[model samples]
Target: MAEREREPAGWQLEQSAPEAYERYLVPPMFAPWAERLIDATDFERDDRVLDVGCGTGIVARRITDRPGGVGTVVGLDINEKMLEVAETAAAKSQLEIEWRRGDVTDLPFSDGAFDVVLCQQALQFVTDPSAAFREMRRVLGPGGRVAASVWRPLEYNSGYVELAEALERHVGDDAETMMRSPFPEWTGEDLGTLVRDAGFSESLRTIEIGSMRYPSVEEFVRREAASSPLSEPLGNIEPDVREALIEEVRNALEDYIDDEGIVFPMESHLLTAQR
Candidate 1:
């Protein structure tokens, strides 16, 4: 594979991985931050909310169930594959959320079109987060609020740390680096810098840490290996070797397993700013 193509794969998608993303990764990885990010927003009954770089409408769907009636909640993403799954999910749940195909750097909406914007764990995956932040500011009405989160770092995100360690023990450092790429630029000051560079007011950057629980190690391994962009690196290895590494990782997680499932820690830096 080309070097550029060798980067981690979640932001973009393969043909059939969307369902896996929603089924396997949403609860353990994205939903905690999604719930907290939405709660941190100053949403009103009739405010228009936009979730940029929304994956599977996790945050947008939750907005519909918030206290009062919201005017409009739109989920915008660059990947149609993701949008398709998100749309299917909304239909299945009988929720009304507008899912659109658009880039965050140049949002396909009029100026000052939304009253609030939320992005969760997506900024680091973008090639140009500064431009995306500016577009976020541009799309917001006066007194509009923005709340977003990015994974703090691999060391603080226990599940990924152990996963990366297992991959390094087998696949080498290239894969390890790709696995760890989603968490740079996540410090409170670093997050504040993002909004500052985008020409927005200083943000209140705080850390929101949560624990993720999975039913079992087997389920976690199956979903992660089958669904993530990290799967690409494993494709170059022998089946036996790959399975061995999965088993190794699963065994390592036995320490965190409880009756509820395997519990692991996760941390994200939540940044709330104004337009």
Candidate 2:
């Protein structure tokens, strides 16, 4: 039998993961942050919005539900499966959202096409986040807003940090590094730089959202294992190693659990830019 190879290192895995579980998993994990982002935008009823990298239309759906928010909301994503899920969810809510399959860096809209372009938890996956920002700027009308958020270093994100540590302990020394650096590791400064280069003036206050707390370690693990494409790669690991990884992750959570349940801290940067 031919030996299996490790998945290539880059943004491709982030762009496309063939797991329905993972794709649908993000909404619940990020519900708190998602609501905060929507509130930050203070979306108006008539704003013609474009949600870039609009995975499953979390942002898009929210906007559609806004009072007097009957204006158009166009959500674009490269993964059709994600769009499909978003479409179904949107339909259930009796909301109308135009979900299209398209790359973030290569948007299919005309210049000055939208009043606001929003992206949430998606910049990290773009091979060229700077290019994606530029595309976002191009699609926005003058004085429009570009809003985005990205996870900070794995160290600040307990879920990812623990997962990386677990992968290292069980899989190999390279596992932690590979998982930690899954996409481009960005800080607030890095995100600011990318937005500035894309021709958007960064808002002085980098609206920092509070850390997310999961009810319990088991629930946290379940959501992560189900939601992130990270699980897809585990199938490549040896079964023994995979089992060890699960145990290690469980052990790591012991430090964070309390009578109130596991309170893992997840830090991410939310920024608004004026185009």
The local distance difference test score of each candidate is 0.80, 0.70
Q: Point out the worst 10-residue segment of candidate 2 by lDDT.
A: 1-10
Clashes of 2: 1
Write one digit per residue (lDDT tens) for candidate 1, span 108-199: 99999999999987888899988999999999999899999888888897777887788788788977887788767467887788799988
Q: Highest TM-score: which candidate?
A: 1
Error of 2 at 44 (Å): 2.8
- How high a TM-score does candidate 1 get? 0.87
Q: How do the predictions measure up, each by TM-score? A: 0.87, 0.82
True-structure RMSD, every candidate = 6.8, 7.5
Clashing pairs in 1: none
Pairs clashing within candidate 2: 22-227
